[model samples]
Target: MTVAANGVLPRPSRRRPPVTWGNPLTYGLALAVAAVSIAPVVYVIVGGFRTTPQIVADPAGLPDPWVFDNYARVLTQSDFWGQAFNSAVIALGTTLGVVVLGVCAAFVLARYTFRGREALYTFFTLGLLFPAGAAILPLYLMLRDLNLINSYYAVMLPQIAFALPLTIVILRPFLAAIPRELEDAAAIDGTGRLGFLWLIVLPLSRPALVTVGILAFVASWNAFLLPLLVLGDVSLHTLPLGVQNFSSQYTSDTAGILAFTSLAMLPALLFFTFAEKQIVGGLQGAVKG
Candidate 1:
């Protein structure tokens, strides 16, 4: 330790090291994987600007003279907008349901002490292993019997249920990390349990909630099989179902199909992109806790 003229030792520096990209091979592999995942999406968006002849001549070539006709036509279609609205409704509904239910359940599991609490949490953890595909048959039958087969609830309800486990899993740790002193302080300040949760817990857990909400929204937006099984009506179709129907209807119109697909997926991609940081922060907090 260095001593100053006054004979006091200097304070140690706490600055972090300068960051650098480590492991060239790892970065190369990551870039390769990202390229592979992104190539098809890029192709679809770029293909929307090319004519059918250009695509047929050079399957992987860029647009020579970019044209906006494909996208323009898609925008002009009433079906596209209608399907988009349906998708927005379902995604938003699913996000709201998942966040509300997941938060309530996670708060209970994290804060309360009771018999079978761990068991209940474990039961929810087990739900993670159950995929929607396995239960689609019975789900469809149940929805059908309930006369909800053609309704938005048919998709939103099951999606919320399937999303609950992960949502709670991510949120429980975040909520539990709230120091007990804060709860006591809130109690002394005339805050009840629900009021504490509302006034303090929710604000503190915003990142985790946003993470789960975006996940649920994106999942619901991209869902196909459930909507396909339940939403047979053309008027009720979500974007995925709309994409399939559009592709089928325009089998030979490759450019138009590509445009339609690009448009359909753009919203979810944009939404996720914008909220990427919250997702990472929430997951990091969960891991830290």
Candidate 2:
């Protein structure tokens, strides 16, 4: 047997594992799901250029006589620009507020446990149970009492408050995972709490920050009810409110509605397109933390 083994090649030692996509059915199903999800977005963008009649006749097909007038008209509208600017302001302000307050609060709660810490955190976490729409009545009353109606603060303040709970939830786990030894070393080397936060904790927390910041920005940009309730001035309308108003103003114009909606959604789409990888990558790192 030993001599025979030497004379002939040995039998194969092992078999390779099957390739992941070797199953046609599995890949086919994945492609179907992707197509289903992407179809509506594609239709919206394409349908924006179609006339009302064309859209009605062939809702899923390309425009025969493509109309650029609808988008061009919207582009020239001052109200569109005003609302878009308002949306940018609200998104930026709310994200900044949530980041600064959430980071500082999450750092303290995660690093140094004190009396009522659990209670406070639980209280904030409870905010997640109820959405902004659920608390509309009281929110309106509080804002009215503060004379903040029809103001940017009316929108931004509530958004900041509502965003905090989620920000804390995202940030606390990551911050708590930070090594205490590094903070202690910083303290020995003349770093105060603020200094340790700025020089150490914040730098290490880029992933969590990016994740929460994007979330807050997106949520604020897409907010509807709060802005609708608080903002009576047409000039102060955000993008969502603008879309609603635009649709109402052009009630008979389906093409205009589709075009406005497509335009309104473009900022969010472009932002996600670029930052999709960042959000995914950061989330992977943050989950480990």
Evaluated with lDDT, which candidate comes out highest?
1
Model 1 earns a TM-score of 0.87
Off by over 4 Å in 1: 1-15, 20-34, 283-289
Candidate 2 error regions (>4 Å): 1-22, 56-61, 278-289
Candidate 1 structure quality by residue, lDDT tens digits, 1-289:
2213432223346455445554556566678889999998999999999988888899899999999999999999638999999999999999999999999999999998999999999999899899889999999999999999889999999999999998999999889989999999999999999999999999998878898898788788889999999999999999899999999988898999999999988987888789889777766765765
Candidate 1 worst ten-residue window by lDDT: 1-10
Please estimate how well model 1 matches the true structure, expressed as its whole-model Cα lDDT.
Answer: 0.89
Q: Write the per-residue lDDT of candidate 2 for residues 54-96, one digit (tens) a residue.
A: 8778767798888998888788963788899999998999999
What are the Cα lDDT values of the candidates?
0.89, 0.86
**C-alpha TM-score for every candidate:** 0.87, 0.87
Q: How far does residue 287 in candidate 2 sit from its true spot (Å)?
A: 7.3
| RMSD per model, one decimal | 7.2, 7.6
Clashing pairs in 2: none
